[model samples]
Target chain A: MKARQQKRREGRDSENALIFGDSVRKCKTLGVAKRAQEEMVGFMLVILLVAIIFLIFLGLASMRSKSNVRESAEVSQFLDALMELTTDCRITSFSGSVNPYKTVEELIRDYDRDLTCENGEKARDVLTRTIQEAIETSWVFSPESLYQGYTFEVDQTTGSGASSTQERIVELTWQGNAFSCTHAIGDTKSVFSASSTIKARLILCLSRSE
Target chain B: MAFVLVFTMIFFGIVAVIYTSVSLSNLREQVAELRERQALERARQLTGVPEFAFTPISCSSCIDFDKALALKQVRTYQDFWNIKFLRLEVVYPTPIDKDKECSLSVLPPNCGYVDIIPSPSGNIKTKTAFVDLVFWDKNKGAYVKVLGRVHISAFDVER
Candidate 1:
C-alpha cells in the first residue's frame, strides 16, 4: 500500500511541471511581439518627420526663386527707365550757341568733363550736384528702404567694358538720395550715355543693407 | 507589421501629392514671369533702335514719335502683331505706377480681332509692364511723355 501511494504523488508533480513550462513559453512569445510593435512605431515616426522636413525645404526653395525673379524684373525696368530719362542741361558756348542737351544722355555726364564754370564750379563739383538732382527728377525714383541701398556707376567701356566694377563707397539717407555720409570721390558703377552711336557702360548695384 | 507598412505608405503618398500640386501651381507663375522678362528685354532693345534712339541737338533722352509712326517695316495686322503687343505709356506728369496706357498699336486697323493673333486657342496667361518714358512728338509739335507698357501673353503646352 505504501509503494502505491508514492507512485501517485510523483505523477501529480510531473503534471504540474508540464503546465507551468507551457505557460512560460507563451509569455516569451508575447514579449517579443510587443517589442517588435514598439520598434515599428518608432520607425514610422522617424519617416514622418523626415518627410515633413523635406516639404519645408521645397517650400523655402520656391519662395526664394519667386523673390529672385521679382528682383530681376525690377532691376530691368529700372535700367530701362534710366535710359529713357533726359535732362535739359543745355550748356551754352560762345561759338554761337551749342545745344549740348540733345546728345547728353544724363546730366551726370558732365563728371568726365574737366571744364570749369564761370561760377568757379569744377566738373567734379557739378557732378555731385547733378547726381543729387537727377535722383529727385527721376521718374522711376523710389524712396530708399532701410534694408536696401543702391549705387550708380559709369565706366568708359568704349573699347571693351569697365575695367573694374568694385570701387568707391557712399552712404545714403533712408528716405531718398540724401547721403548719410559724404565721400569726396563718389563710387561709379556704370551708367552709359549715348552721344551718336557711341555706347557707354553703366552699372547699378542694389544691395541688402543688413 | 502589416499595419506599420500600410501607415507608412499612406503618409508618404500624401506628402508626394502635396508636393506635386504646389510645384505645378508655382510652375504656372514662373512661366508667366519668364514671358514678362522676355518682353522687358525686347522693350530695352526697341529703345536702342535707330528710329527711337535718335537725339537731335535740342533733344535729350527723347524718342522721335514721327519716326516711330513712319515705321512701314511692320505691315500686316498679324505680322506686326508682336509690335502691336508692345505698349508705350508716358508717366511724366503722373507717378510711375500710374502711367497712362498708350500703344502705337492702338491706331485704327492694327488693334482688332484678337483671335487672329498667334495662339493655339485656349486660356492664355498675360502680364502688363508699366515702362516709363519721355517722348518727343515731331508731328504734334510738343513733348509727350511716353512709357513702354508691354502686355506679354503666353499659351502653355506640355513639351
Candidate 2:
C-alpha cells in the first residue's frame, strides 16, 4: 500500500512539470509573432514618411520652373509704340496749309464712322494694311527664332458701364513653325474715343529656346 | 544600440547639409534675377525724364525728335545720366538713307538715327526698347509719330 501511494504522488509531479513546459513553449511563440508585427509597422511608417518628402520636393521643383516664365515688358512697350505710329491715310476734313495725317490710334476710332481718306481709300482698309505691314516688319517668327507665332487683335467697345457692347475690329494670326508653342507673353493697350473705346492686344507665342 | 544612434545622426547631418546647399543656390539665382529686373526698370525710367518726353502731345510713351536732337548737343546731360551709351533710332517709314546719322541740318527722311551719347569702349551689352518718336513734318505741315527704338547701356561698376 505504501509503495502504491508513493507511485501515485510521483506520477502527479511529472504531469505538472510537462504541462508547465508546454505553456512556456506557447508563450515563446506568441512573443516572437508580436515582435515581427511591431517591426512591420515601423518599416511601413518609414516608407510613408519618405514618400511624403519626395512629393514635397517634386512640388517645389515644378513651382520653380513655372516662375521662370512671366509677362514680358518688351511686348508691352512694343504695343504702346505701335499705336502711335502715323499712317498715310489723311483725313479730308483737315486740309489746307496743314494737312493732318491720321495716326493708327485715330484710324481705329474713325473706322466706325466710315470716313474716307484723301486718297479715296476706306479708313478700314488703310488701317488693316498699315497694321499688317507693321507687324510683319517688327516680328520674325520661325522655329529657329525665339518666337514661334503671334496674334494681334483689336476690339472696340461702344457705350459706357453695363450697356457697353464689345466688337472685334480685327484679328491677325501668324504661325511660322510646326513645333508646338511652349509659352506665351502678351499685353494690351486702350484708346478712348468720343463714343467708344478701342483695345489692342498683342500676344507672342514662344518656342522652347525662349 | 550606440552604433545605430551614431549612424542615424550622421545620415541626418548629411541630409541637412544638402538641403542648406540647395537653398543657398536658389537664393543666389533669385538675387541675380532681381538685379536684372532693376537694370531694366532704370532703362525704362530714361523715357520718363522731361528731357526726352514729348510734352505737347502729353503722351507718356512719345519721345520728341526735336528734344532728343537738341539733348545731344548739351554736354551737361552726359554727367547727369551717368550711362555709357544712349541712342534713338527710327525703325519704320524705312529711311531713304539708312546709314546717315541725324543732325539739326539733316533730318528724318535723310537720316535714320541720332546718337545722344555715343557708345563707350568696353564689352558692355546694350538694352533696347521700342518708343514713339514724334517730329514736325514740313511736307505734311503737322506732327508725325513714327516707330522708334531706344538703346541704352550702363557703365560697368563693380557691386
Best prediction by lDDT: 2
Instruction: Please tell me which predicted candidate would have the highest DockQ against the true structure.
Output: 2
Regions of model 1 farther than 4 Å from truth: A2-19, A22-26, A41-45, A48-69, A72-75, A92-99, A102-210, B39-63, B71-88, B93-159
Candidate 2 has a TM-score of: 0.76
lDDT of 2 by residue, A1-210 (tens): 999999999999999999999999999999988977876676556556755886798688788776323456677788878778888888758443143688788778777878788899988888888887776666787778877777788899988889999999988888742223467777788887778888988777777533
lDDT tens digits by residue: candidate 2, B48-121: 89898887766767888988899999988887878878888877776789789998777776789998988777
Q: Which run of 10 residues does model 2 chain A get worst, by summed lDDT?
A: A176-185
Model 2 regions lying over 4 Å from their true place? A1-69, A92-99, A158-165, A176-180, A193-197, B1-37, B156-159
For model 1, what is the error of residue A114's alpha carbon versus the real structure, in angstroms, after optimal superposition? Answer: 9.9
lDDT of 2: 0.77
